[model samples]
Structures are given as C-alpha cells and as structure tokens.
Target chain A: MQLLIGTQAVELDKEGFLKQLTDWNEEVAIKIAQQEHIQLTAAHWEIIELLRKFYQLYELSPSMRALVKHTEQTLGAEKGRSVYLLQLFPPSPAKLACKIAGLPKPLNCI
Target chain B: MTTNNKSITCKKLLFISRHAPYGTSLAKEALDAILAASAYDQNLSLLFMDDGVFQLLSAQDPSDLEQKNFAAMLPVLALYEIENIYVHFESLQARQITINELILDGVQVIDSKTICSLLTQQDQLLSF
Candidate 1:
C-alpha cells in the first residue's frame, strides 16, 4: 500500500509497516495517524519521539511491557501504565507507536 | 503492526498448544510466537491441552535427549506480560499430572466450559 504525504507517495507493506525506513518523518507520521483516524496530539507526539529514540538506542521497538516500563522510568509512573498508553494510542500502543514513529514492526507483534 | 483508517482496537488473541515438547519443535515455536504476540499489545491467552499439558512438568531434564530445555521459557512468559496462561483440567487429569507438579506459576486450570466461553470471546485463535 502507498500513503500520500504532502504529494509524496510512501510505500508500506501489506501489513501496514513502513516499506522504507527512510520514508518516515513528522509529515508521514501525521499521514499514518490520519489513516488510523487518530488526530495527532501533543501527548501522542511525546510518545512517538520517545519510541523513536528507544529504537535508535536499542535497535528494536519496545514490547508492550518494555514500553510501559520505559515510559514509567522516563516519562514517570503516572504515564507508564498500559491504561494511559492505551488511552492515548487506543488498543495496541507498542505496535501503533512504532508505526507512527516510522520504525519497523516490533518483533513478535504478529 | 497493523494500520488502517479504522481506529485501533485490542484483539483478544488465543494460542492453543496441544503438542508435547522435544518430539518436535512445535512446542517451542508456539511459545515463541505467543511471546512475540505479547509485544504487539494485544490481549493474549495461552492454552495447553491434550499431550501439550506435559510441557509444564517440573524438573524437566533434557540432558539425556541433548535438546535445549524449551520448558524454561514458560516461566519467562510472565515477564513478557503474558499472564493469562491456562491448561485444560481434563487433559491434566488424563495425563496424571497435578498442578503442583507444573514448573510455572500463575497458570489457571480451566475446564471445558471456560475454554469454550474463552473461544467464543476471542477475535482470533491459533492452535499449534
């Protein structure tokens, strides 16, 4: 599938993960969020940046448990709970966060 | 990772394992898949039945078989936040296995009624 971001066509796999890692950016993130019917909020961007930074350091997307733990340690305990992330990203925070962050599908997300 | 115009939703995914470990790689592979799925942020439940219940036996020694001890992974599932592990009650009784003999903790022994209700509630079911 292809996502049109500001007239630029970005490719995605059948499963909706980014086909080209370099094709991701804030603009693409917005487009992807829009496709998911989520209007980007400041809170969402905060988690997205955190997820990208995590991927850069660990070379892997955080699992749900890891994401919650990292969020608690970095963002604070109030924000680390799955309930908080779920409220922001809806059902699957780890998978959706990675998708918006322009990272590969998190390992074991299938 | 799944994306679409539709809003994101949590999928209650159930994985059923009915094979014994070491005879083949099916047991380990199933556990691996479930662990991976746990990262996806879905509601995951793992059920062991039939010969699969033997996998939870404690003090498993694979030295004689020269195989990796895949049963060790059972305890680690909780770390992945996969806390909803279930074993068929009848399967255990048939195999002469007791709950105390299982190596892992926090496993729920479920009867067929509960299993059927769970099956009806799941959005997806994978059996291995």
Candidate 2:
C-alpha cells in the first residue's frame, strides 16, 4: 500500500506503517495521524519524537512496557503514565505512536 | 470435605547465550525471548558465555550488514527490568576482551563455579 502526500506516493506496509523509514517527514506523519484520527497536537509530537529517537537508538520499536519506562526515564514521571499516553494516542498508544512515527511494528507488542 | 488448590508461582528463568552476535540469529533470538518474558514479571537473568560475550562489545557497527547492532539492544534490558546480566570470566579472558570493552554497565563477571551455582538455581534454562 501507499500514502499520497500531495503529489508524492510513499510506500507503506500492509499495516499502514511506512515501507521506507527514510520516506517519513512531518507531512507524512501528519497524514498518517489523520488516518488514525489523531489531530497531531504538541503532546502527540513529544511521544512521536521519543519513539523516533528510540528507534534510532535501539534500531527497533518498543513494546508498551518499554515505551512507558523510556518515557518515564526521559520525560519525567508526569507524562510517563499509560493513561497520559492513551490520552494522546488513544486505543493502542505504542502501536499507533510507532506507526505515526514511521517505525516498523513493535516486535513484542502482541 | 476438603479441596485441593494450586498456587501460582513465578519461575526463575535463566537464558544462556552462547553464540556470536552477527554469525547467527541465536543472540538476537535470546534477547527477544528475554524481553518477551520480562512482561510476565518472572525472575529472569542472562549469562553470556562462549562467543556470546561478543554481543556486549562496544563500538559494534552492523550497518554494512543491514543488521541491527546487537550491542545496542543491551541497554534496553535494564529498562525491561531484566537486570541480572552476567559475563563469563574465562570467556572474556579467552577472547582477550577487557571489562571496559563491554557496552552494558553493572555486568557481574563470574567464574565457572558461580555459573554452576547460577544454573542450579534456575527453575528453567533457555539456551541459545
């Protein structure tokens, strides 16, 4: 599958994650967020940025438990709770946030 | 009248990684299994012996091979609450690797006797 951003077509996996991580940009993230019914708020961007940094560091996406621990370590206790993340990216935060951040599906998510 | 009830217990799992990081998938597979088992909140520990000690070497760059650098994942183990990482003393001596060459912090270097006791303490052993 592919996502059309203006005139460019960005390839995506069947699960709507970006096929090429390099193809991701702010515009691409906004487009993906729109599809997921998220409005791309500042709070959302914070976690998205965190997930991207996490991928760069570990070369893999994080499971929900890892995500929570990482956020707690990096962003302090206030924004680390699952409830805080769920409020920003509802339903499933880790998977949805990773998708919007252009990372591959988390291996241990299931 | 009497009833029989079973109690839930967390098993002590020990993962023994014996392969080099890049040569086979065993190293990565063991790491993945360790992470997956962390969710269960069980007693988990890791031992790196044989060629597996290479997985903890610093400055590992697998970019050319298009594989994730296994050393990079070691730090995440602490975040998953799988902290008890151990390295075989003889393995490092055999490989001519020093303690500073390892990437992860707080790794307990143990001799064969300690390893023997560690094995005996585990409720289950998962070898890679």
- For every candidate, how close is chain A to the native chain A in TM-score? 0.95, 0.97
For B1-128, candidate 1 gives per-residue lDDT tens digits of 45553325678899999999999888888887887887567899999999899899987778699665655557657657888999999999998899999977799999999999989888789989
List the candidate 2 regions with Cα displacement exceeding 4 Å: B1-9
* Tens-place lDDT digits, model 1, residues A1-72: 999876779999987889998898899999888877789999999999998887655456667787888798
- For each candidate, the alpha-carbon lDDT, in order, equals 0.84, 0.91
lDDT minimum window of 10 residues, candidate 2 chain B: B1-10
- Candidate 2 residue lDDT tens string, A14-92: 9899989999999999999999999998889999999999999988788888999999999999998999999998899
Can you list each candidate's DockQ?
Answer: 0.13, 0.71
Q: What share of the true interface contacts does each candidate keep?
A: 0.28, 0.56
TM-score (0 to 1) of chain B, per candidate? Answer: 0.90, 0.93
Cα lDDT, model 2, residue A1 = 93
